[model samples]
Target: MTRPRLSAVSVLTFSALIILTGCFGPPAPAPTSTSAAPTTTAAPTTSPAARPTGVTSAPAAPLSTAAAPPSSAPASPPPTEEPVPGGLPEQVAPLIIYYVAVEDNGVSGPLIGCGDSLVATTTAPVRFTDQVRPSIEALLANKSRGVGLSGLVNVLYQSNLSYAGGELTGSTITINLTGQFMLGGVCDIPRAKAQLEYTAMAAAGATSAQVFVNGRPIDEVLSLT
Candidate 1:
């Protein structure tokens, strides 16, 4: 007995059913367990600290060891002295002056001659250099007293010699005479010169003396040592 042959349609239908079964086999299984998602942590960041406003820093120390300059010092002043005009200092001590004087004899009747120029004299104490003027003034003051020149009158003119002024320069003295200091008439020029010179030199303690008459040098011809 021969078996019956399957139809082509039936065969094709079985093959198609097998392929469809394989393709649609079973659903994929879900992930067994999800690990916690990896945590996303931003790396730690560094930031500068903030300072408050108006903060001040300490001052720095000086680098040098030298001291600060010293403050300037105050200044000082000058000195003074007492005034002494035409004279030595003051009269802390007394000084002496020599004045010519006259001596008399009953016979010669007042000893009038230059040979006795101040041969008879008086002495006095002085206080100032300027006092020299007045001292000489006193010596020649009273011609009638005849002290200044009477001793020399017989030899000299004795013109009532007048004293105008006098001044001293160091060791020198200058005496001025006015009013006919030429002596009325030149009799014994040398003796007249002696009378004045001796008196001034003695009173002033001068090394030398200059005489002026009528504002002019007494004639050099009349110069006395």
Candidate 2:
């Protein structure tokens, strides 16, 4: 018998068949992969009080708004002093008296007797006539007869008069005179008793005459004599 002809094709065919059979065999039971059952971790437990609530906290109370204390008011200004009259002292009162007679030719006689007195709250009556009379006589002597008479009468009516000597006080003045007068060149009894009251108030050191006639207010008749 001739040895079976070993052809290259037949040899190759048998080898291939073996290789395929091995490859098709069920894949070796997949390696039993039991990844140690993932280690089970226990969740942390919380008490009911620890649970987070959705509510937010309220704001604190507002600060008090009490007003600041008020500032004190400024003090008032001091009162102003009044200006004193001219030709007079700062604090003095005057009293004056005049005596005159009408001449035959309608002229006025010289100032015969003149006097001044003063009364202060804490002191006795002060008579300044000796010092005051001469000055008053000089004033009368210088004036014309008509003016002198008028001026004398004016002086009598107006009580308060301040001159070189001092001041006089009291709201009223009394005059008693006994003299001869001539209306139209005839001698006549010019005796008169007159009482003068000051209606207008006089300042402490006023020099001018500021009095009224008998029972008459100063405003009614301001005639100088």
Candidate 3:
């Protein structure tokens, strides 16, 4: 009796499902969460004993331990003086020099002035000055050589002549002599006087001479001789 109830509706529904599967297969499989290719970051480089502390070095000081010295100025020089015009007076002492004179020509009637020829070695280089004493010393020593020099060949001789000192004025020199120095004989006195005068004036660069014996001027002795 139920076999007679079968219908087309149920059969059609089953056929529609079959047709959807044939047209489009089952949905694609769900996508899985896969890891990306590993990243390749470079590691940061660092100096030994230095890192994220970020500490830095300090600047060095210009000078070490030592300090500089203080400055000072130099000293000043001394002042000087200018010299006088024509220079100073000349005076040289204790020198060796010739005692100069002229030889006399007369034997009698008293000799007058000195002549030209010299008794060259009658006196040696002796300590000289522009003074009378030194001159007298030299003259006497030469006279002491006897006969051929200050003394006469036969008629006279000059002995024991002595000079004290002298003073120079203008072109003349006044010489002081000892009294006994002029106590010589007549003819010899004049010649001796000539020698004394010439030597002294020559040394002093003077042209005339005046004599004083024992503080007495020899004008009379000169007149007598």
The most accurate candidate by TM-score is: 1
Question: Sorted by TM-score, highest first, which candidate order results?
Answer: 1, 3, 2
Error of 1 at 210 (Å): 0.8
lDDT of 1 by residue, 1-225 (tens): 999999999999999999988999877686666756554543333522343334333456869988988768754556667755763654422323232233323243223343232352554555554555655665555354233443423223345556788888999999998765434433345446655666687767788888887787876535531
**C-alpha lDDT values of all predictions:** 0.56, 0.33, 0.55
- For every model shown, what is its TM-score relative to the native structure? 0.43, 0.18, 0.42
Q: On TM-score, who's better, 1 or 2?
A: 1
Q: Which numbered prediction scores highest in lDDT against the true structure? A: 1
Question: What local lDDT score does residue 116 receive in model 3, on the 0 to 100 scale?
Answer: 26
Q: Kindly report which residue stretches of model 2 are placed more than 4 angstroms away from their true locations once superposed.
A: 1-65, 70-96, 102-105, 109-190, 193-225
With candidate 2 superimposed using the best TM-score fit, by how many Å does residue 146's alpha carbon deviate from the native? 22
Candidate RMSDs in order = 22.5, 21.2, 20.9
Q: What's the lDDT of the predicted structure labeled candidate 1?
A: 0.56
Model 1 segments more than 4 A misplaced: 1-86, 89-120, 123-129, 145-162, 182-187, 220-225
Q: Tens digits of per-residue lDDT for model 3 on 1-225?
A: 556754699778889999998899888887667846555543344653553344333345677667756557665666767766572344545422232233544433223544422232233344433445665565555543244444433112244446777888999988887745433454455555666666667666689988887777776656655
lDDT of 3: 0.55
